[model samples]
Target: MAGPGGWWGRKSTPAKVETYTRWSFYLIALSEPLVIGVTALGQVEARLALLFMVPVVGHVALALVLVSRALDWTAGRRPQPLGLLGAVGAATAVLAVTSLVLTQHGPDGEGAETVLGAVFGTTVTYGVGMMALAMKERRRVVWLVAGYGVGAGLVASALGVPAVAALSMAAFMTAASGFIAATSCFSVWLLNAVYALDEARETRARLAVAEERLRFGRDLHDVMGRNLAVIALKSELAVQLARRDRPEAVEQMIEVQRIAQESQREVREVVRGYRRADLEAELSGARGVLRAAGIDCEVSGETDGLPAEVQSALGWVVREATTNVLRHGDAKRCTVTVRRPEGRVVLTVRNDGATAPHGSSRAGGTGLAGLRERLSDVGGTLDAGEAGDGEFRLVAEVPLTARPALEVVS
Candidate 1:
């Protein structure tokens, strides 16, 4: 359990979801203005059009900055941009409202309504931009957003635009409020979901590592525990016999030495066996490991009557393939098949979600190259490439015509 000192941790990034929401906000920023421009085409005076452009552009820049910072925060990046852009956007929104109010001739006319309509529409976009920054900063600023919304609504009302109407400037502003709520709240919810997923994945990886370590420790204890105990007891007995000056004491001592030597040899054999690769054992292990990693693995093969050399070579291939599947790709299903048709043993590992391996060339890292070398020693060939539709296939074929000399494993 974590201690009290570490109970409440700092906030983190939203990762995968940040990119999506940022792009969504970008689309909103791009489209909202175009929409308002179309709606106010004939009503706005030419002299005051440039004033409107400033706030729109400023608000978009501010929103982009917010989403970009949010992305950086989630990804654990450093040196984020300063937060002054939101302040600038807020000031620009004030200017826009002032300009719209000054230009209005009367409260109920088409020209007055159009300017107020554009002002109110973009005010909602500005509110969204502020809410985004608050979320990125992980601060309690909903009250600030609420206050800003009220202020914008009041500005609209001053020019004969109500906050709520069935088919007027008030209605569009009301929709803007809804838009702000949906985007802000949805982005937050999605961020939390993404964070939870990342946490679960990390937990799974840590558990797998811990389980492997425990298994190795248990195996070592089983292999050497009893042998060491027997050696200790025998040495004590031999010492007592030697103190009594009996000739049998020497024999006892010699027997103890022989037993110690045998135990040493046994330990070496045990360690070597633990390290050596066996095809059947590799297949079984691969299945268990893949299943533990939430991947469905189906293996089909006949292991009987195979040359030991071929099995060992193919075992390495299976081991390497399993590691790559777990570490490199986001695979969900893996199929391993072994066939001995036409006097040659063919082993194929096919898996979905295989990405192109990164590094020099496409043949993958040094591990596959080593496997290729091992296979070649037994008249075998290895081929690996994409099988289309996001599938990766690896095939290792070794001829059975020439029986390979058994290779000693140390």
Candidate 2:
């Protein structure tokens, strides 16, 4: 079995919100029986209290079922609970009529009237509120609440209640139900907003990856497109010349070979540039991307004097760490620090979210393994793992030494 907090800790932000909202409605449904049923027992005769308890308990049960189904419908997990919604509405009407009958003939005391009034108002308020959650439009929610309030008054007046008292009941029901309706609607809205934001964050990460791929593709095309066309034309001309036994055909073929060799070198340069990361640029980008994703990212380091190879390796570390923070965990804050301690330049990135394990494959990609390979090339070391207190930390260390710069082909 999982530990005490494991169940809750495993749930995502939106799932937590959904659970909280669903249980809030459940609590309201449960409170109906505890508040109204218990009040009925103490304030009225046993038989009459039982009469009131019957409908109150029944309504609470039906409300619980409807709340689940309605929320499921709202989340698109299931079809609309049209049948359940109608049943709950019918139960609410029955509860209201029962309360009115008891108030009219079953009792003649202040306590009895108070309990019956509580039953009538509370039932209608919660019932309307619960139904409002499944409604697609605010206008329908308004109409539903108004209709119930007006219906309450009409039912009271038809049962011979005083006109002024019936009007007061209508107003009370309308205002109370309106408050509950607004609360329910707001809860649903907040839950949806949370889910939408999480999805948008994922989309942003995907878009960033796509944009980087497009950049690489464009660079490759620019490097190879012209060279490949020239090589093809030269080869075709050489073929025609060689068939005519022209001496220039040998020269043209040699030129084509040189062009092909140059193309190969250029392609390697493009790949090298694409693979290499600038430490300063990566640091700045990591901060911006994390901050845009609602993470508080703090960078406290300089990359000015680092060797190119060391910087490139550490820069990959920063990029990968930032991506993990964005895609793997629910991190709130990230801290990146670079320190040169005598012989080694140490880069550390720590985040408050620790869901992703160290060296884990990321979305079918090499993940930390790729980072490890990059760091190894520069004679650096990488360490990534949970650092306790719900934090994940990645540390890369490269020796501070002069490294030969990559030679460019002339």
* Best-fitting candidate, scored by lDDT: 2
Residue-wise C-alpha lDDT for candidate 2, range 182-254, written one tens digit per residue: 9998998998898898889888888988998999999989989999999999999999999999999999999
How does model 2 score by TM-score?
A: 0.90
Question: Which residue segments of model 1 deviate by more than 4 Å?
Answer: 1-21, 36-47, 78-89, 92-96, 99-116, 133-149, 158-175, 184-199, 236-246, 276-316, 330-334, 352-354, 359-361, 366-381, 387-390, 398-410
Worst 10 residues of 2 by lDDT: 356-365
Pairs of residues clashing in candidate 2: none
Pairs in steric clash, model 1: 13-74
